[model samples]
Target: MNPPAEPPSRAALQAAASQRLHPLSWLFLLLAQLRAFALPLLVLLFGGGRREDGIADLIGLLAAGLLALTAVWRYFTYHYGFLGQALVIRSGLLQRNLRLVPFDRVQNVTVHQNLLHRLFGVASVRLESAGGLGQAEAQMDVLRLDQARALEALVRQGAQRARAAAAASGEGPEAATPAEPAPVLWLHLPMRELVRLGLISNRGMLVVAALFAALSQAGDAVMKPLGNQLYAGLKEGESWAASLHLGPLAYGLASLLLLLGLLALVRALSVALAIVQFHDFRLLAGERELSVERGLLSRVRAHLPKRRVQAYTLHESLLHRWFGRRSLSVDRAALETGNEAAALRELVPLATPEAMDGMLQRLLPEGSWPPRHWQPLHPRAWRRVAFPGLLATLAASGLLVAWKGLPGLWLLLLLPLVVLRARIWARYSAWSLEGGVISVRQGWLDRHWRFAEVRKLHALELRQSPFDRRHGMASLHLDSLGAHPMAPPLRIPYLPVAEAVRLAAALRAGMPRDAGVSRARTAA
Candidate 1:
């Protein structure tokens, strides 16, 4: 029997000729182009057009043919290869383009395989660097799965070598030890946990709202019919209820029950969606990188270098508290764009508080967790928070009184609730600076804890509002690379101006020399 063949060495692979994309790349590219123009094409085909002459149909066919030809041209022109420690890519037909990306600058490598790609034994590979803003530095539409994996491995190896060389030159040979090969399993979310996560999240409501907005944008032609059908259903429901001749209390109870039933249905849909999206979710940690694998219909495999993580966030919503769960996410140096944005955010989507603490300890051994003492904000911070609520309440009450006279007086009852909320927020919100890590906590009901190593922070801002200046208090904002725009900011609000200034100086002093910390003062 013939012996099994050994895998090729790095030197051998690098010496090999430049590689082109898989033969089926054109098909995938065509499909992508069609998806991008799907809305316009649908309008051209079905909307009022030259149907008798079939001119619109002819135009669509011609457009599709042109797209197919372009895809083929792109496939034939694009070529990629390795040159020393950099990956070289050459493309473009009319105006040739060449790009060389050094492995050390690559922060994340993602491999995606939808159902179609999996069926065809192919995968889409994306390389994300720190300088691409929110876009991937390079994307390979479709490649053989084995070849893609090989390319990822090569990049990882090259990056490791670069890091080792830098460490040896800067910190001596002891700091340049090779990374461990064994991978540690960090988390494996079961179906039950996914269901819990879905229950805790408002994804279902967001999806419903998005659908409603889309329907509203479909113009009266589509929404008018839907509105009519809904109105007719409501009329039928009212008639049926009247036929029952139910008492007022009974009617109220029935309506409440119906509302609850609808909520239950929405929650069920959310559970199913979560299960489909995160089935068989697993997070693994190697010495130098973290690996995430998840999804049911469209599998995704992503790799993030450990050093690329810039900041960490812990979230605990009211629903999460009820379920005894919390979530953990990270801001990495690479900003993933498009469908890949959701790839590596949820390092721990849902877990017990104790479990999350343990995971954090294992993942970030350099930093401390659960600070022993939290530094409180200014003594009058509660008043600062409550003032806005009080003003808003007064304004709303005045408007309601103008609209409905004495009946609107009841709105003033919300004033106390607003004050209570502000008090809670002021009491819970705090900051901690310990062991080269800076942590900030905020929120009353849905709490967020954002933290980062001092060295990772790139900028700091101190701002003073007119009210803040009058009260001798200010706010501090800490900026890190690749932070999610929608996530709660890492800001410490309502701090004494002197304290804020001292804190900013201390943080800047702790930052690494090469980090180039920038400070700014702004008035708002």
Candidate 2:
């Protein structure tokens, strides 16, 4: 029998040149670089009085040539790299930076080939860290889809081999078996939801339009003075009319309109870019983790391992309710640097309530499903959500009335006071808890369900105010594991004494191990 062929060495496999950027990519880079340097070069050339300075001209030429060459070298070094068991990147001129990413630590590898990339036979690869900390490690402007796919497969195989080796050397069964694959759950937002979510998003085209209008107007005001001063400086020997004559008001108006038009164009382009990046976005729920992929220019892939997710929430705004859409967010305290963990880890733009419920079941551990419908422990729980705000408003109104006469004071505060009272009342609506999960619902014009597993809870607090003590009632706040700065822990404002104790008992009992048992408990 012929001897078994030797496996290719990592260095041998990586010896071949991968791919090159399309010629157009170089042109695009050149234009962007030129724009960045143009103003500085102009300042150097024109800022000083006209002088026959051959030395300055030669110096400028040499600097421009050096800058251009440096840009080309940097791009080549960063983009070209070798793929192996550990990522081997060769970057920099004098001191090379080599990044070695072990396969087991790689959460997910995503490949994106846009229209331009397709035309050029190139793609970008994103490597998300499985450990769920720090920004994703990315390789951009790479060459060819096949190479990236091959690299991903190689890494996966190496990870499996590594695990097997570890197991043979006395690792536990859990170490041998990679975490269970996450359930392949998908939630799609209908077009109706897109419009509704976009409308209420508060950061839509209208805001962009208004911002552009303000920016354009401001830019014009700033530029006019600079332009006039420049003209005065340049034409010092010319007549006053030649140097300082302002355009006719009609002409100025036309120019303003043109500037506004340009601003609108730029704004629309930016919005289009953002929309495309978020367009047709899908979030996949897996048994082991949550995966996210989005964007066009720079594709992004994020993995939130089940162990990393601190909290899971479902929210319905007024617009969402109207359009049958719900927003789902997963919080991971591991992402502590970000301001709002909810914003960063939103599963999808829009999904139905049923879908949201299904996803919640999949993401949380066994027994962690929010009770769909249950009576609040306290009949006056609504009062808890609303009363404080109402009392504050009324007190403010009284103070104002005492200081000022009733004539305008009532006008100033009556409608607002009524609105506040109505809002507080609405917010107090209802909250409930059952089985493995706790549900807290509140909103004046919108509603939400925050579902968290007992296992997911970092800590719990039971609070009783003076009034609560008088009424023999208390409040429960459940703290989930994520990094949402603005999110208050789930608050159950009013719970009667007995029911509060019962709920606390169940929470402490811990979730049952069997999936069926957990479901049965929730049903019970």
Which model scores highest in lDDT? 1
Candidate 1 local lDDT, 265-367, one digit each (tens): 8898888878877889998999878898888889988887777889999999999999999998899886766545576887778889998888777666455
Alpha-carbon local distance difference test for all models: 0.85, 0.59
In candidate 2, what are the lDDT values of residues 1-524, reduced to their tens digit?
33534654645434433444433444345545777888777656655656686666676677677777866775665534444445555456587664556665665555665555666666656666634564666444454567766765665566556565557567535356544464474754444444455555544455567866865765655678877998987577346435566568855786799798876565555445445555556576665556665654544444455666666667778777777778777677455233122324776666777877776666554554656565545765555545666677677767877778674356445555655655574445566555556677666566666666666675555667777876777766667645476554576666786777676666656633321111111111
Clashing pairs in 1: none
Candidate 1 structure, TM-score to reference: 0.90
lDDT of 2: 0.59
Q: What pairs collide in candidate 2?
A: 182-286, 182-287, 182-288, 183-286, 183-287, 382-428
- All candidates: TM-score: 0.90, 0.64
Residue 224 accuracy (lDDT) in model 1: 89
- Clashes per prediction? 0, 6
